[model samples]
Target: MAGTLKVGLIGCGNVVDYGHRPALLALKDVELVALADITPARRLIGKAWFRLRERQLYADYRQLLALPEVEAVVVAVPQKFRPRIVLDAFAAGKHVLSEKPLSNVPAVAAQLVAAARHSGLQLAMTHNYHFLPEYQKLKQLLSQGLIGAVRVLTLHFLGVIDYPGAAEYQADWRHTLAAGGGVLMDMIHAVYLAEWLAGAPAQQVMAFVDALQYAGREPVIEDLALLQIAFPRAYAAIHMGWGAGVGGLDISGSDGHIRLRYKQHQSGGFNQPIELYSVDSDWRRSDHAIPNLDTHEANIARSFTQLWADFRDAIREGRAPIAPAAAGARALEIVLGAYASAVCGRVISLPLAAADPVYQKGIAGIAELEAWAGSKTKAAGLFGLRA
Candidate 1:
């Protein structure tokens, strides 16, 4: 607790190996003290990769949480399992940095937020995109009035799930309603980025969803979800999908506009470019490509490291967490509202109450819904056999 903050890590999935482990290791102020994983194979991989001693391994996260030296926890568990682990960490008197999308349901997310607040522990959400240098520079420019009163924001985020040939690979727990999968939850990075750049919470939202390309897959969750949000001084639109396409954002303001495009490769690399246009000189344009900076994966690791550094500083100062618990919950609310709007065929407003039909029915005790989704999916020939 004095020189290096002892860190306990939960979950040893691909994200932990690629992102969290490297990030935590890079920070001099932090030490990876303990790790927990349900899978022995994963725990072994983490232990071997990080050179952790055998005594630091645990199959149950509660044991890790009980470590007196652990001042904080980095929760990299799957989205569905996060809420419980986060709450437990707080109850054990440890701060938390949870992976994105918060949890599978808004109700569960709310409980996590409440627990963090009550325990007076910092709760930060990993929204690495917001910490990208280009994004920060852009935000600084906008705050300096370079764009002069924003008016509109638009984004297109689409990707293909390279899930071999198994139905479970594509329509597994993550895609089920109970697990809070589908386009809305899986592709919500755009929603978080938009709200952050727009500098305001979405006041109202309207959405349209459909089972566009993956009709053969089971589970009625939509493959495409188009969302529109009306903010106080700006309006925003997002097109999310699971098809083979990619695009980025275009923000138009009274005086200028900014554009970005992202390309993902099967070879595990990415190309991204950000451009700016100003109306002052007949809409003159200037653009720059984000340097790959040693593989896109490394860039993500660096970003995550920066994110955790900010969280550490916030915890030390007794200030708000880098990405506060409320912000994480609010992001979930926006995604849930979008889904509710699509299902109910109407616009949905913010600050949803516990009595809202969507909250009561759509997200309430999702295990039942997951089971139903699994059955419906299996019956619908999601396993790739035609009935």
Candidate 2:
């Protein structure tokens, strides 16, 4: 807590170029001690970015984990390869900061959370959207009773940019079913934000998930997902897609309503927000100024920086990080549930039953469920559902 925190990084992918690199460079109390990536080019890129010596770079992440100076590590690999590394980190007595969606399978994600709890090591999620200035202000207003009791929260991210993975790896991995689900799974940010804003865990979820953009190609994953989720006392609807479409946030509360519009109708991380305002019961409109009004790129960098700081402080104070592993697990279940709902045409419950195939195998288990004749996901050939 007093001195610097030494950290190692795994998976030197494209996310490091924008998301984590700036944070590691900006946080004075955190040092990037080592980096690991299977791809040599990516490892070299990280070496140059972090100014790490050849000895500090590794092809096997286990070597980086072996370092005694690394008190913590950030796991930035794809969801499929993360479980083992994270488990190994906890076993090695190192705190872990994991990227989103925890794991492709809900059961596996739960196991990671349990492992972290049993090890008494931190397992924080990179739900950095919580630290974004717009979302932070939105949470502030909601907590201050600006919207009274939240009734319905809608997040529109239809214009998500389809950025590819590192060229050294599978660039089109996201378009495959192996990536888990699709755009919604890739951007699980809206899912966690829904729970955080609703102030409870999701109870039930149903969705219409389809590959509208790649429908003609018989895509293995969905490009558009419309989900309706039920919390204890509030509801949230998330509209997500990978193509050009609407993008913004709208909240309808008992006392008032709030709306956020991004510039150029781009998604949250793509462009700066141009408008944010609220309306009261009396139809009085009030505009809220965004705190960090720099370029969207700078805002995103700041969010990651704050997230790393929170991770550091949480470790020092023996407290939970702003985004904990439990939240990520729940979000993963919500997404897997949504995919199940699309395939089976039924609302899926939370903390899915242990006996449920989807709970055990994630999107891979959708084929085990009875499919509806009219299910759009089935029609679109997503999640192994045949028309």
Q: Write the per-residue lDDT of candidate 1 for residues 81-148, one digit (tens) a residue.
A: 88889988988999999988888667777888888888999899988777665566567767888768
List candidate 2 segments past 4 Å from native.
none
Error of 1 at 219 (Å): 3.7
True-structure Cα RMSD, model 1: 5.0
TM-score of 1: 0.87
For residues 81-137, could you state the per-residue lDDT of candidate 2 as single tens digits?
A: 999999999989999999987899999999999999999999999999998889999
Q: Which candidate is the best by lDDT?
A: 2
Model 2's C-alpha root-mean-square deviation from the true structure amounts to 1.0
Model 1 stretches with alpha carbons more than 4 Å out: 160-171, 263-270, 274-281, 288-294, 360-387
lDDT, candidate 2, at 266: 77
